[model samples]
Target: MSLSVSAVPPLLPAASYEYRTVRPVHHGHMGEPRTDVLAAEEPLEISLVYGPEEARRRRTLAVTMRTPGDDAALAAGFLLTEGIIQHKAELRAVVPCPDVTKAEERGNVIRAELVPGIVFDEARLERHFYTSSSCGVCGKTSIEAVQAASCPVLPAPAPLLPAALVHELPQRLRAAQAVFDQTGGLHAAALFRPAGELLLTCEDVGRHNAVDKLVGHALLRDWLPLHALVLLVSGRASFELVQKAAVAGLPVLAAVGAPSSLAVQAAEQFGLTLLGFVRDNRFNIYTHPERITG
Candidate 1:
Protein backbone atom coordinates (compact mmCIF):
# COMPACT_ATOMS: atom_id res chain seq x y z
CA MET A 1 0.00 0.00 0.00
CA SER A 2 1.11 3.57 -0.63
CA LEU A 3 1.78 5.49 2.55
CA SER A 4 2.03 9.24 2.95
CA VAL A 5 4.15 11.42 5.23
CA SER A 6 3.80 15.17 5.56
CA ALA A 7 6.87 16.78 7.13
CA VAL A 8 10.29 15.21 7.45
CA PRO A 9 12.53 16.55 10.18
CA PRO A 10 16.15 17.54 9.60
CA LEU A 11 18.65 14.74 9.27
CA LEU A 12 20.61 13.77 12.36
CA PRO A 13 24.35 13.42 12.37
CA ALA A 14 25.68 9.87 12.60
CA ALA A 15 27.16 8.72 15.90
CA SER A 16 30.10 6.42 15.39
CA TYR A 17 31.70 6.45 18.82
CA GLU A 18 30.60 5.57 22.35
CA TYR A 19 32.56 5.02 25.55
CA ARG A 20 32.49 2.66 28.54
CA THR A 21 34.79 2.29 31.55
CA VAL A 22 36.04 -1.09 32.77
CA ARG A 23 38.52 -2.49 35.27
CA PRO A 24 41.16 -4.88 34.00
CA VAL A 25 42.53 -7.97 35.77
CA HIS A 26 45.39 -9.69 34.03
CA HIS A 27 47.72 -12.62 34.70
CA GLY A 28 46.31 -13.20 38.19
CA HIS A 29 46.89 -9.54 39.08
CA MET A 30 44.59 -6.54 39.29
CA GLY A 31 45.22 -3.84 36.68
CA GLU A 32 44.28 -0.19 36.75
CA PRO A 33 40.80 0.77 35.60
CA ARG A 34 40.58 2.58 32.27
CA THR A 35 38.07 3.99 29.88
CA ASP A 36 37.72 2.17 26.58
CA VAL A 37 36.38 3.41 23.27
CA LEU A 38 33.78 1.15 21.75
CA ALA A 39 31.61 0.90 18.76
CA ALA A 40 28.27 2.45 19.59
CA GLU A 41 25.59 -0.19 19.80
CA GLU A 42 22.17 1.38 19.82
CA PRO A 43 18.68 0.69 18.51
CA LEU A 44 17.84 2.61 15.32
CA GLU A 45 14.17 2.68 14.52
CA ILE A 46 13.72 2.83 10.71
CA SER A 47 10.42 4.28 9.69
CA LEU A 48 8.94 4.52 6.19
CA VAL A 49 7.32 7.87 5.46
CA TYR A 50 5.62 8.67 2.17
CA GLY A 51 2.76 10.51 0.40
CA PRO A 52 1.68 14.15 0.32
CA GLU A 53 2.49 16.86 2.85
CA GLU A 54 -1.16 17.58 3.75
CA ALA A 55 -1.88 13.94 4.62
CA ARG A 56 0.98 11.85 5.90
CA ARG A 57 1.58 8.37 7.30
CA ARG A 58 4.47 6.88 9.17
CA ARG A 59 5.24 3.24 9.93
CA THR A 60 8.05 1.90 12.01
CA LEU A 61 9.63 -0.54 9.58
CA ALA A 62 12.43 -1.85 11.73
CA VAL A 63 14.29 -1.42 15.00
CA THR A 64 17.78 -2.82 14.52
CA MET A 65 20.65 -2.78 16.99
CA ARG A 66 23.50 -1.28 15.02
CA THR A 67 26.65 0.68 15.59
CA PRO A 68 25.43 4.20 15.04
CA GLY A 69 26.96 5.99 11.99
CA ASP A 70 25.86 5.97 8.40
CA ASP A 71 22.39 5.39 9.81
CA ALA A 72 20.72 6.67 6.67
CA ALA A 73 22.77 4.22 4.69
CA LEU A 74 22.02 1.56 7.29
CA ALA A 75 18.30 2.10 6.93
CA ALA A 76 18.57 2.41 3.17
CA GLY A 77 20.73 -0.68 2.95
CA PHE A 78 18.34 -2.56 5.20
CA LEU A 79 15.39 -1.67 3.00
CA LEU A 80 17.31 -2.53 -0.16
CA THR A 81 18.47 -5.90 1.13
CA GLU A 82 15.03 -6.70 2.56
CA GLY A 83 13.40 -6.09 -0.84
CA ILE A 84 11.54 -3.07 0.53
CA ILE A 85 13.07 -0.53 -1.86
CA GLN A 86 14.71 -1.38 -5.16
CA HIS A 87 16.96 1.59 -5.88
CA LYS A 88 18.26 4.77 -4.29
CA ALA A 89 15.93 6.85 -6.44
CA GLU A 90 13.01 5.36 -4.57
CA LEU A 91 14.22 7.18 -1.48
CA ARG A 92 13.30 10.85 -1.14
CA ALA A 93 14.91 11.79 2.16
CA VAL A 94 15.86 10.17 5.45
CA VAL A 95 15.15 12.28 8.53
CA PRO A 96 15.22 11.77 12.28
CA CYS A 97 11.84 11.69 13.99
CA PRO A 98 11.01 15.10 15.47
CA ASP A 99 8.29 13.82 17.79
CA VAL A 100 10.69 12.22 20.24
CA THR A 101 10.86 14.16 23.51
CA LYS A 102 13.81 12.40 25.07
CA ALA A 103 17.38 13.54 24.50
CA GLU A 104 18.73 10.03 23.98
CA GLU A 105 16.15 9.37 21.29
CA ARG A 106 17.43 12.22 19.12
CA GLY A 107 19.34 10.23 16.55
CA ASN A 108 18.01 6.78 17.38
CA VAL A 109 14.93 7.14 15.18
CA ILE A 110 14.96 7.92 11.43
CA ARG A 111 12.23 8.05 8.81
CA ALA A 112 12.96 7.25 5.17
CA GLU A 113 10.67 9.08 2.84
CA LEU A 114 9.89 7.27 -0.38
CA VAL A 115 9.11 8.95 -3.66
CA PRO A 116 5.49 9.32 -4.61
CA GLY A 117 3.67 6.37 -6.25
CA ILE A 118 6.03 3.84 -4.72
CA VAL A 119 4.21 1.27 -2.64
CA PHE A 120 5.40 0.42 0.84
CA ASP A 121 4.97 -3.26 1.62
CA GLU A 122 3.57 -3.21 5.13
CA ALA A 123 2.92 -6.96 5.29
CA ARG A 124 6.46 -7.80 4.22
CA LEU A 125 7.86 -5.42 6.84
CA GLU A 126 5.54 -6.82 9.53
CA ARG A 127 6.93 -10.25 8.79
CA HIS A 128 10.59 -9.26 8.93
CA PHE A 129 11.27 -5.94 10.70
CA TYR A 130 12.05 -6.84 14.32
CA THR A 131 15.64 -7.91 13.76
CA SER A 132 18.21 -8.32 16.49
CA SER A 133 21.99 -7.97 16.27
CA SER A 134 22.43 -11.72 15.88
CA CYS A 135 19.42 -12.67 13.78
CA GLY A 136 17.49 -10.94 11.02
CA VAL A 137 14.41 -13.12 10.69
CA CYS A 138 12.45 -14.91 13.38
CA GLY A 139 9.12 -16.36 12.19
CA LYS A 140 9.31 -18.07 8.87
CA THR A 141 6.95 -20.81 7.80
CA SER A 142 9.33 -22.21 5.21
CA ILE A 143 12.61 -21.53 3.43
CA GLU A 144 10.58 -19.95 0.66
CA ALA A 145 9.64 -17.10 2.95
CA VAL A 146 13.28 -16.25 3.39
CA GLN A 147 14.05 -16.83 -0.26
CA ALA A 148 11.15 -14.70 -1.37
CA ALA A 149 12.51 -11.69 0.46
CA SER A 150 16.12 -12.13 -0.71
CA CYS A 151 17.68 -9.79 -3.26
CA PRO A 152 18.99 -11.45 -6.39
CA VAL A 153 22.78 -11.64 -6.81
CA LEU A 154 23.89 -12.42 -10.31
CA PRO A 155 27.09 -14.27 -11.08
CA ALA A 156 30.12 -12.31 -12.22
CA PRO A 157 30.97 -12.73 -15.87
CA ALA A 158 34.69 -13.28 -15.19
CA PRO A 159 34.87 -15.54 -12.17
CA LEU A 160 38.52 -15.50 -11.23
CA LEU A 161 40.52 -13.70 -8.51
CA PRO A 162 44.21 -14.14 -7.72
CA ALA A 163 44.87 -16.15 -4.57
CA ALA A 164 47.59 -13.69 -3.59
CA LEU A 165 45.15 -10.78 -3.88
CA VAL A 166 42.62 -12.70 -1.83
CA HIS A 167 45.23 -13.32 0.86
CA GLU A 168 45.92 -9.61 1.22
CA LEU A 169 42.29 -8.59 1.82
CA PRO A 170 42.08 -9.60 5.49
CA GLN A 171 45.11 -7.50 6.33
CA ARG A 172 43.69 -4.48 4.53
CA LEU A 173 40.42 -4.99 6.32
CA ARG A 174 42.28 -5.13 9.62
CA ALA A 175 44.18 -1.95 8.79
CA ALA A 176 40.91 -0.06 8.30
CA GLN A 177 39.35 -1.26 11.55
CA ALA A 178 39.87 1.87 13.67
CA VAL A 179 37.19 0.94 16.20
CA PHE A 180 38.39 -2.64 16.58
CA ASP A 181 41.94 -1.44 17.14
CA GLN A 182 40.88 0.65 20.14
CA THR A 183 38.27 -1.63 21.70
CA GLY A 184 39.34 -4.94 20.12
CA GLY A 185 35.67 -5.76 20.37
CA LEU A 186 33.95 -4.98 17.11
CA HIS A 187 33.31 -7.03 13.99
CA ALA A 188 34.20 -5.54 10.61
CA ALA A 189 33.05 -5.81 7.02
CA ALA A 190 34.96 -4.44 4.04
CA LEU A 191 34.56 -4.22 0.28
CA PHE A 192 37.44 -4.65 -2.10
CA ARG A 193 38.20 -4.84 -5.76
CA PRO A 194 39.28 -8.13 -7.28
CA ALA A 195 42.88 -6.94 -7.27
CA GLY A 196 42.74 -6.28 -3.45
CA GLU A 197 42.10 -2.56 -3.36
CA LEU A 198 40.07 -1.64 -0.29
CA LEU A 199 36.99 0.40 -1.09
CA LEU A 200 35.22 0.79 2.23
CA THR A 201 35.20 -0.66 5.72
CA CYS A 202 32.77 -0.54 8.64
CA GLU A 203 32.89 -1.88 12.19
CA ASP A 204 30.13 -2.80 14.59
CA VAL A 205 29.40 -4.85 17.68
CA GLY A 206 27.33 -7.04 15.39
CA ARG A 207 28.83 -8.63 12.29
CA HIS A 208 25.68 -8.20 10.27
CA ASN A 209 25.46 -4.56 11.29
CA ALA A 210 28.92 -3.99 9.93
CA VAL A 211 27.87 -5.48 6.63
CA ASP A 212 24.70 -3.39 6.67
CA LYS A 213 26.67 -0.20 7.18
CA LEU A 214 29.05 -1.09 4.40
CA VAL A 215 26.25 -1.95 2.05
CA GLY A 216 24.33 1.15 3.13
CA HIS A 217 27.31 3.34 2.35
CA ALA A 218 27.47 1.80 -1.08
CA LEU A 219 23.75 2.31 -1.51
CA LEU A 220 24.07 6.02 -0.77
CA ARG A 221 26.79 6.24 -3.41
CA ASP A 222 24.58 4.46 -5.95
CA TRP A 223 26.88 1.46 -5.87
CA LEU A 224 24.48 -1.43 -5.54
CA PRO A 225 24.78 -4.71 -7.43
CA LEU A 226 28.35 -5.08 -6.27
CA HIS A 227 29.26 -7.76 -8.78
CA ALA A 228 32.90 -6.83 -9.19
CA LEU A 229 33.69 -6.48 -5.50
CA VAL A 230 34.85 -8.90 -2.84
CA LEU A 231 33.42 -8.76 0.67
CA LEU A 232 35.55 -9.63 3.68
CA VAL A 233 34.27 -10.07 7.20
CA SER A 234 36.34 -10.13 10.38
CA GLY A 235 34.29 -12.93 11.91
CA ARG A 236 32.75 -16.22 10.86
CA ALA A 237 30.56 -16.37 7.81
CA SER A 238 26.96 -16.54 8.97
CA PHE A 239 23.91 -17.04 6.77
CA GLU A 240 22.93 -13.43 7.42
CA LEU A 241 26.30 -12.18 6.22
CA VAL A 242 26.04 -14.28 3.09
CA GLN A 243 22.53 -12.97 2.57
CA LYS A 244 23.66 -9.34 2.81
CA ALA A 245 26.46 -9.94 0.35
CA ALA A 246 24.05 -11.64 -1.98
CA VAL A 247 21.65 -8.73 -1.71
CA ALA A 248 24.44 -6.32 -2.58
CA GLY A 249 25.45 -8.52 -5.55
CA LEU A 250 28.89 -9.25 -4.21
CA PRO A 251 30.44 -12.26 -5.92
CA VAL A 252 33.17 -13.17 -3.45
CA LEU A 253 32.64 -13.44 0.34
CA ALA A 254 35.72 -14.19 2.42
CA ALA A 255 35.76 -14.56 6.19
CA VAL A 256 38.57 -14.80 8.69
CA GLY A 257 36.66 -17.57 10.40
CA ALA A 258 34.58 -20.54 9.27
CA PRO A 259 31.27 -20.62 7.45
CA SER A 260 28.08 -22.10 8.83
CA SER A 261 26.24 -24.90 7.01
CA LEU A 262 23.39 -22.60 6.09
CA ALA A 263 25.86 -19.98 4.92
CA VAL A 264 27.51 -22.42 2.56
CA GLN A 265 24.10 -23.52 1.36
CA ALA A 266 23.03 -19.97 0.63
CA ALA A 267 26.23 -19.31 -1.25
CA GLU A 268 25.73 -22.44 -3.28
CA GLN A 269 22.16 -21.52 -4.04
CA PHE A 270 22.91 -17.93 -4.97
CA GLY A 271 26.12 -18.40 -6.98
CA LEU A 272 28.33 -16.64 -4.43
CA THR A 273 32.00 -17.43 -3.96
CA LEU A 274 32.19 -18.32 -0.25
CA LEU A 275 35.58 -18.52 1.43
CA GLY A 276 36.33 -19.26 5.08
CA PHE A 277 39.38 -19.64 7.34
CA VAL A 278 40.79 -16.80 5.28
CA ARG A 279 44.07 -16.21 7.13
CA ASP A 280 47.76 -17.21 6.95
CA ASN A 281 47.62 -16.93 3.16
CA ARG A 282 45.20 -19.88 3.04
CA PHE A 283 41.41 -20.18 2.77
CA ASN A 284 38.79 -22.75 1.95
CA ILE A 285 36.40 -22.27 -0.91
CA TYR A 286 33.02 -23.59 0.14
CA THR A 287 31.04 -22.65 -2.93
CA HIS A 288 31.53 -21.34 -6.49
CA PRO A 289 35.24 -21.94 -6.52
CA GLU A 290 35.45 -20.79 -10.13
CA ARG A 291 35.52 -17.19 -8.96
CA ILE A 292 38.90 -17.58 -7.24
CA THR A 293 42.02 -17.62 -9.40
CA GLY A 294 45.03 -19.47 -8.05
Candidate 2:
Protein backbone atom coordinates (compact mmCIF):
# COMPACT_ATOMS: atom_id res chain seq x y z
CA MET A 1 0.00 0.00 0.00
CA SER A 2 1.19 3.50 -0.77
CA LEU A 3 1.88 5.60 2.28
CA SER A 4 0.45 9.10 2.34
CA VAL A 5 2.44 11.76 4.12
CA SER A 6 1.40 15.29 4.94
CA ALA A 7 2.82 17.82 2.52
CA VAL A 8 6.20 19.10 3.59
CA PRO A 9 8.79 21.33 2.09
CA PRO A 10 11.33 19.81 -0.26
CA LEU A 11 13.85 17.71 1.61
CA LEU A 12 16.50 18.60 -0.94
CA PRO A 13 16.78 21.19 -3.66
CA ALA A 14 15.73 19.97 -7.08
CA ALA A 15 18.69 18.07 -8.45
CA SER A 16 19.36 15.22 -10.85
CA TYR A 17 21.90 12.41 -10.71
CA GLU A 18 23.10 10.19 -13.52
CA TYR A 19 22.57 6.43 -13.27
CA ARG A 20 24.12 3.94 -15.69
CA THR A 21 23.30 0.33 -16.46
CA VAL A 22 23.98 -2.35 -19.06
CA ARG A 23 21.11 -4.45 -20.43
CA PRO A 24 21.05 -7.40 -22.80
CA VAL A 25 19.84 -6.19 -26.18
CA HIS A 26 19.48 -9.67 -27.63
CA HIS A 27 21.16 -13.06 -27.56
CA GLY A 28 24.90 -12.65 -26.87
CA HIS A 29 24.56 -8.86 -26.98
CA MET A 30 24.55 -6.06 -24.43
CA GLY A 31 24.25 -2.26 -24.45
CA GLU A 32 24.98 0.51 -21.97
CA PRO A 33 22.46 3.25 -21.35
CA ARG A 34 23.24 6.57 -19.67
CA THR A 35 20.23 7.86 -17.82
CA ASP A 36 19.51 10.80 -15.56
CA VAL A 37 16.80 11.07 -12.91
CA LEU A 38 15.92 13.10 -9.86
CA ALA A 39 17.98 12.15 -6.82
CA ALA A 40 15.87 10.78 -3.93
CA GLU A 41 18.11 10.14 -0.93
CA GLU A 42 17.73 12.68 1.89
CA PRO A 43 19.10 13.10 5.38
CA LEU A 44 16.69 12.30 8.24
CA GLU A 45 17.89 13.30 11.67
CA ILE A 46 16.25 11.51 14.61
CA SER A 47 16.11 13.05 18.07
CA LEU A 48 14.71 11.59 21.29
CA VAL A 49 12.68 13.41 23.96
CA TYR A 50 12.41 12.00 27.46
CA GLY A 51 11.61 13.05 31.02
CA PRO A 52 9.30 14.35 33.71
CA GLU A 53 10.55 17.54 32.18
CA GLU A 54 9.16 15.85 29.05
CA ALA A 55 10.15 19.08 27.42
CA ARG A 56 13.82 18.55 28.12
CA ARG A 57 16.37 15.72 27.81
CA ARG A 58 16.79 16.17 24.09
CA ARG A 59 19.80 14.64 22.33
CA THR A 60 20.82 13.80 18.79
CA LEU A 61 21.21 10.12 18.00
CA ALA A 62 21.72 8.90 14.41
CA VAL A 63 21.59 10.48 10.97
CA THR A 64 20.36 8.29 8.12
CA MET A 65 19.92 8.47 4.34
CA ARG A 66 16.35 7.59 3.56
CA THR A 67 13.56 8.34 1.10
CA PRO A 68 11.95 10.89 3.50
CA GLY A 69 8.95 8.82 4.61
CA ASP A 70 8.21 6.65 7.62
CA ASP A 71 10.78 8.59 9.65
CA ALA A 72 9.46 7.39 12.99
CA ALA A 73 9.48 3.68 12.12
CA LEU A 74 12.85 3.99 10.46
CA ALA A 75 14.27 5.54 13.59
CA ALA A 76 12.72 2.92 15.82
CA GLY A 77 13.95 0.03 13.69
CA PHE A 78 17.44 1.48 13.49
CA LEU A 79 17.56 1.83 17.24
CA LEU A 80 16.25 -1.68 17.83
CA THR A 81 18.65 -3.33 15.33
CA GLU A 82 21.60 -1.34 16.64
CA GLY A 83 20.69 -2.40 20.20
CA ILE A 84 20.35 1.24 21.13
CA ILE A 85 16.94 1.35 22.74
CA GLN A 86 15.47 -1.96 23.94
CA HIS A 87 11.77 -1.31 23.34
CA LYS A 88 9.36 0.95 21.50
CA ALA A 89 8.29 2.70 24.72
CA GLU A 90 11.80 4.05 25.16
CA LEU A 91 11.31 6.09 21.99
CA ARG A 92 8.97 9.01 22.67
CA ALA A 93 9.13 10.60 19.26
CA VAL A 94 11.25 11.20 16.09
CA VAL A 95 11.43 14.52 14.34
CA PRO A 96 13.50 16.41 11.83
CA CYS A 97 16.58 18.13 13.20
CA PRO A 98 15.90 21.75 14.07
CA ASP A 99 19.36 22.64 12.87
CA VAL A 100 19.77 20.41 9.86
CA THR A 101 22.61 22.51 8.58
CA LYS A 102 24.26 22.45 12.01
CA ALA A 103 24.10 18.67 12.16
CA GLU A 104 24.99 17.36 8.67
CA GLU A 105 23.45 18.70 5.48
CA ARG A 106 24.40 15.69 3.44
CA GLY A 107 21.69 13.35 2.12
CA ASN A 108 22.70 10.70 4.68
CA VAL A 109 22.45 12.13 8.20
CA ILE A 110 19.66 12.36 10.86
CA ARG A 111 19.43 13.08 14.59
CA ALA A 112 17.56 10.99 17.21
CA GLU A 113 16.81 12.31 20.69
CA LEU A 114 15.89 9.99 23.57
CA VAL A 115 13.54 10.16 26.55
CA PRO A 116 14.69 10.55 30.16
CA GLY A 117 15.28 7.48 32.39
CA ILE A 118 15.99 5.75 29.09
CA VAL A 119 19.74 5.80 28.94
CA PHE A 120 21.01 4.08 25.84
CA ASP A 121 24.01 1.80 26.04
CA GLU A 122 26.32 4.04 24.08
CA ALA A 123 28.91 1.33 24.39
CA ARG A 124 26.80 -1.17 22.44
CA LEU A 125 25.87 1.32 19.74
CA GLU A 126 29.48 2.38 19.34
CA ARG A 127 30.40 -1.26 19.21
CA HIS A 128 27.90 -1.86 16.42
CA PHE A 129 28.91 1.32 14.58
CA TYR A 130 25.99 2.32 12.38
CA THR A 131 26.40 0.53 9.05
CA SER A 132 25.68 1.99 5.61
CA SER A 133 23.39 0.61 2.93
CA SER A 134 26.24 -1.03 0.99
CA CYS A 135 28.19 -2.54 3.91
CA GLY A 136 27.41 -4.46 7.10
CA VAL A 137 29.79 -5.47 9.93
CA CYS A 138 32.45 -3.32 8.37
CA GLY A 139 33.25 -0.98 11.25
CA LYS A 140 32.41 -3.23 14.18
CA THR A 141 34.75 -3.13 17.14
CA SER A 142 35.31 -6.89 17.01
CA ILE A 143 34.12 -10.01 15.26
CA GLU A 144 33.86 -11.76 18.61
CA ALA A 145 31.73 -8.89 19.85
CA VAL A 146 29.18 -9.55 17.12
CA GLN A 147 29.40 -13.27 17.69
CA ALA A 148 29.10 -12.81 21.43
CA ALA A 149 26.14 -10.47 21.07
CA SER A 150 24.70 -12.51 18.25
CA CYS A 151 21.38 -14.02 19.28
CA PRO A 152 21.05 -17.78 19.02
CA VAL A 153 18.30 -18.86 16.63
CA LEU A 154 15.02 -19.79 18.25
CA PRO A 155 14.55 -23.55 18.32
CA ALA A 156 11.02 -24.22 17.21
CA PRO A 157 9.55 -27.00 15.11
CA ALA A 158 10.00 -25.96 11.51
CA PRO A 159 6.66 -24.97 9.94
CA LEU A 160 4.81 -27.59 7.93
CA LEU A 161 3.85 -24.99 5.30
CA PRO A 162 7.08 -22.96 5.30
CA ALA A 163 8.70 -24.22 2.11
CA ALA A 164 5.72 -23.61 -0.11
CA LEU A 165 5.26 -20.18 1.44
CA VAL A 166 8.94 -19.47 0.82
CA HIS A 167 8.56 -20.38 -2.83
CA GLU A 168 5.57 -18.06 -3.19
CA LEU A 169 7.28 -15.04 -1.55
CA PRO A 170 9.33 -13.70 -4.46
CA GLN A 171 6.39 -13.31 -6.79
CA ARG A 172 4.28 -11.82 -4.03
CA LEU A 173 7.03 -9.43 -3.13
CA ARG A 174 7.49 -8.40 -6.76
CA ALA A 175 3.78 -7.85 -7.18
CA ALA A 176 3.78 -5.57 -4.15
CA GLN A 177 6.83 -3.50 -5.13
CA ALA A 178 5.09 -0.32 -6.23
CA VAL A 179 8.01 1.95 -5.39
CA PHE A 180 10.55 -0.28 -7.08
CA ASP A 181 8.41 -0.30 -10.21
CA GLN A 182 8.56 3.48 -10.30
CA THR A 183 12.24 3.97 -9.42
CA GLY A 184 13.83 0.70 -10.48
CA GLY A 185 16.55 1.69 -8.02
CA LEU A 186 15.13 0.59 -4.68
CA HIS A 187 15.18 -2.59 -2.60
CA ALA A 188 12.23 -4.16 -0.77
CA ALA A 189 11.38 -6.27 2.28
CA ALA A 190 8.03 -7.80 3.12
CA LEU A 191 6.32 -9.81 5.86
CA PHE A 192 3.93 -12.57 4.87
CA ARG A 193 1.60 -14.68 6.96
CA PRO A 194 1.94 -18.45 6.84
CA ALA A 195 -1.19 -18.56 4.71
CA GLY A 196 0.31 -16.17 2.12
CA GLU A 197 -1.05 -12.75 3.00
CA LEU A 198 1.23 -9.72 3.12
CA LEU A 199 1.09 -8.04 6.48
CA LEU A 200 3.36 -5.18 5.56
CA THR A 201 5.83 -4.28 2.83
CA CYS A 202 8.35 -1.47 2.64
CA GLU A 203 10.82 -0.26 0.04
CA ASP A 204 13.90 1.90 0.31
CA VAL A 205 17.13 2.71 -1.42
CA GLY A 206 18.78 0.36 1.07
CA ARG A 207 17.76 -3.23 1.73
CA HIS A 208 18.47 -3.04 5.47
CA ASN A 209 16.31 0.05 5.87
CA ALA A 210 13.50 -1.63 4.01
CA VAL A 211 13.53 -4.48 6.49
CA ASP A 212 13.84 -2.04 9.34
CA LYS A 213 10.80 -0.13 8.18
CA LEU A 214 8.77 -3.34 8.04
CA VAL A 215 9.91 -4.38 11.52
CA GLY A 216 9.30 -0.92 12.86
CA HIS A 217 5.81 -0.98 11.44
CA ALA A 218 5.23 -4.31 13.16
CA LEU A 219 6.52 -2.89 16.40
CA LEU A 220 4.27 0.13 16.12
CA ARG A 221 1.33 -2.18 15.55
CA ASP A 222 2.41 -4.31 18.55
CA TRP A 223 2.96 -7.44 16.49
CA LEU A 224 5.73 -9.12 18.39
CA PRO A 225 6.36 -12.86 18.20
CA LEU A 226 6.71 -12.88 14.42
CA HIS A 227 6.83 -16.65 14.11
CA ALA A 228 3.58 -16.71 12.16
CA LEU A 229 4.99 -14.53 9.41
CA VAL A 230 7.71 -15.21 6.85
CA LEU A 231 10.17 -12.42 6.06
CA LEU A 232 11.21 -11.93 2.44
CA VAL A 233 13.68 -9.66 0.69
CA SER A 234 14.32 -8.65 -2.91
CA GLY A 235 18.07 -9.24 -2.88
CA ARG A 236 20.77 -11.39 -1.36
CA ALA A 237 20.33 -12.19 2.30
CA SER A 238 22.88 -10.26 4.36
CA PHE A 239 23.99 -10.81 7.94
CA GLU A 240 22.33 -7.64 9.20
CA LEU A 241 19.08 -8.38 7.40
CA VAL A 242 19.02 -11.86 8.86
CA GLN A 243 19.76 -10.40 12.26
CA LYS A 244 16.80 -8.06 11.93
CA ALA A 245 14.52 -10.92 10.95
CA ALA A 246 15.68 -12.96 13.91
CA VAL A 247 15.28 -10.03 16.28
CA ALA A 248 11.71 -9.61 15.08
CA GLY A 249 11.06 -13.29 15.95
CA LEU A 250 10.57 -14.34 12.35
CA PRO A 251 11.33 -18.06 12.03
CA VAL A 252 11.79 -18.07 8.28
CA LEU A 253 13.60 -15.80 5.84
CA ALA A 254 13.54 -16.03 2.05
CA ALA A 255 15.55 -14.05 -0.47
CA VAL A 256 15.38 -13.78 -4.24
CA GLY A 257 19.17 -13.78 -4.56
CA ALA A 258 22.20 -15.51 -3.03
CA PRO A 259 22.89 -15.74 0.70
CA SER A 260 26.21 -14.55 1.99
CA SER A 261 28.07 -17.19 4.00
CA LEU A 262 27.96 -15.03 7.12
CA ALA A 263 24.22 -14.55 6.68
CA VAL A 264 23.68 -18.28 6.32
CA GLN A 265 25.81 -18.90 9.38
CA ALA A 266 23.81 -16.37 11.33
CA ALA A 267 20.56 -17.99 10.25
CA GLU A 268 21.92 -21.40 11.22
CA GLN A 269 23.00 -20.11 14.60
CA PHE A 270 19.67 -18.40 15.12
CA GLY A 271 17.70 -21.40 13.86
CA LEU A 272 15.95 -19.24 11.29
CA THR A 273 14.62 -21.16 8.29
CA LEU A 274 16.79 -19.72 5.53
CA LEU A 275 15.99 -19.93 1.83
CA GLY A 276 17.79 -18.28 -1.08
CA PHE A 277 17.57 -18.07 -4.86
CA VAL A 278 13.82 -18.07 -4.30
CA ARG A 279 12.64 -17.66 -7.88
CA ASP A 280 10.76 -19.81 -10.38
CA ASN A 281 8.91 -22.66 -8.68
CA ARG A 282 12.00 -23.85 -6.80
CA PHE A 283 14.25 -22.44 -4.06
CA ASN A 284 17.44 -23.44 -2.28
CA ILE A 285 17.15 -24.25 1.40
CA TYR A 286 20.31 -23.31 3.23
CA THR A 287 19.76 -24.11 6.89
CA HIS A 288 16.46 -25.67 8.00
CA PRO A 289 14.48 -27.62 5.43
CA GLU A 290 12.00 -29.30 7.71
CA ARG A 291 9.82 -26.19 8.04
CA ILE A 292 9.00 -26.13 4.34
CA THR A 293 6.28 -28.59 3.29
CA GLY A 294 4.79 -29.81 0.04
lDDT of 1 at 34: 88
Clashing pairs in 1: 4-50, 4-51, 4-57, 5-50, 161-293
How many residue pairs clash in model 2? 19
lDDT values, one for every candidate: 0.77, 0.67
How well does each candidate superpose onto the true structure, as a TM-score? 0.86, 0.76
For candidate 2, write residues 170-233 as lDDT tens digits. 8888877765554677778888767887767877777887888788777766676576778889
Q: For candidate 1, give the lDDT of residue 98.
A: 82
lDDT of 1 by residue, 1-294 (tens): 111222121122335566778888899888888897766678989988876666667888878887777677778888787778778898888777788888988889988898877876567756773343356443332234446775574665844799888888888888877767766878888887787767778777778777887888788777777888889999999877887888888898999999987788778887889999999989999998888777
Off by over 4 Å in 2: 1-39, 48-60, 99-113, 129-152
Count of backbone clashes for each model? Answer: 5, 19
lDDT, candidate 2, at 281 = 79
